[model samples]
Target: MFAFVMRRLAVAIPTLLLLIVFSFILMHLAPGGPFSLERELPPQVLANLNAKYGLDDPLWLQIWNYLTGIVLHFDFGPSFVYPDRSVNDLIAAGFPVTLTYGTLRARFKTR
Candidate 1:
């Protein structure tokens, strides 16, 4: 059973890495960026925003940095939509509500 679990994990780890890389590539390939708006921002402001988020880096470098951050620190980085909060913060904030709903559903289902 241990060996079976190890074998499954070996396959699953690479599969998950591929999934993350592909998703990152696909998101970068899409047209408009997070800073895109109906009213055009000045070039200096746009450049500053890109620099702040490391968006000015090459795609490969960005991917390397992101992967390293996740692997080394287990961080999902910041939230693009909510600049003041991080991805982890958003998840943490919503987790309690999710847990409450799940617990209630499971309790009711078993009755």
Candidate 2:
């Protein structure tokens, strides 16, 4: 049983790394953090906000930091669009919703 689990883990490691790389690229490309859309913050304040989040870090360091953050602390950092929730929690909710897709929708659909 341990061997089987280990074998799958071996395969999954690379897949997870790929996902991290893709996620880092996509998140960095977006305009700003969850607070970015706030009308209250002035332009200069927004620039400071980005820097505080390490948005200006080199791509490799950013990706490495992101990957390590999850493995070491089980965090994917905060939500870029929902400051109140962690990225890990948001991602966790999405999987079951997506996995059960039509079954969930069909139950509430009217004829």
Candidate 3:
């Protein structure tokens, strides 16, 4: 049982890391960013905002920082539009609802 669990964990860790990397790539490749605005901001303001969010860093550095942040802090960082809330907060709030729905779905499907 111990060896089985360890093997599963070995696979799970790389799978999760790959998932994060793919998500990061897709997010960055998307047309607009979390900070996109319909109206243009001044150049200085835009640059400042990018720097503030570490968007000015090289892509590799950004990816490294993002992975390290999650590993060390278990944080998904703040919401893009909703600056007041973190991703973890949203997940916690929604988990109960999702859990109930999933349980119901599975229960009905097994019938």
What clash pairs does model 3 have? none
CA deviation > 4 Å runs, candidate 2? 29-41, 89-111
- The alpha-carbon root-mean-square deviation between model 1 and the true structure, to one decimal in Å, is 2.1
lDDT order, best first, reads 1, 3, 2
- Go through the candidates in order and give the clash count of each: 0, 0, 0
lDDT of 1 by residue, 9-110 (tens): 999989988999999999999998888857788899999999999999999999999998888888889898899999989989999999999999998995
Candidate 2's residue-wise lDDT over 10-106, tens digit each?
9998898898788768876887555646566887877787787776678888788888898898888877677689888898989887868878788
Q: Rank the candidates by TM-score, best first.
A: 1, 3, 2
How does each model score on lDDT? 0.92, 0.80, 0.89
Mind giving the per-residue lDDT tens digits that candidate 3 earns over 1-111? Answer: 999999999999999999999999998999966666677777898888889888999999999998998999998877767778988999999999999999999889953
Instruction: List TM-score per model, in order.
Output: 0.86, 0.62, 0.83
RMSD of each: 2.1, 5.4, 1.9
Q: Report model 3's TM-score to 2 decimal places.
A: 0.83
Could you say which candidate leads in lDDT?
Answer: 1
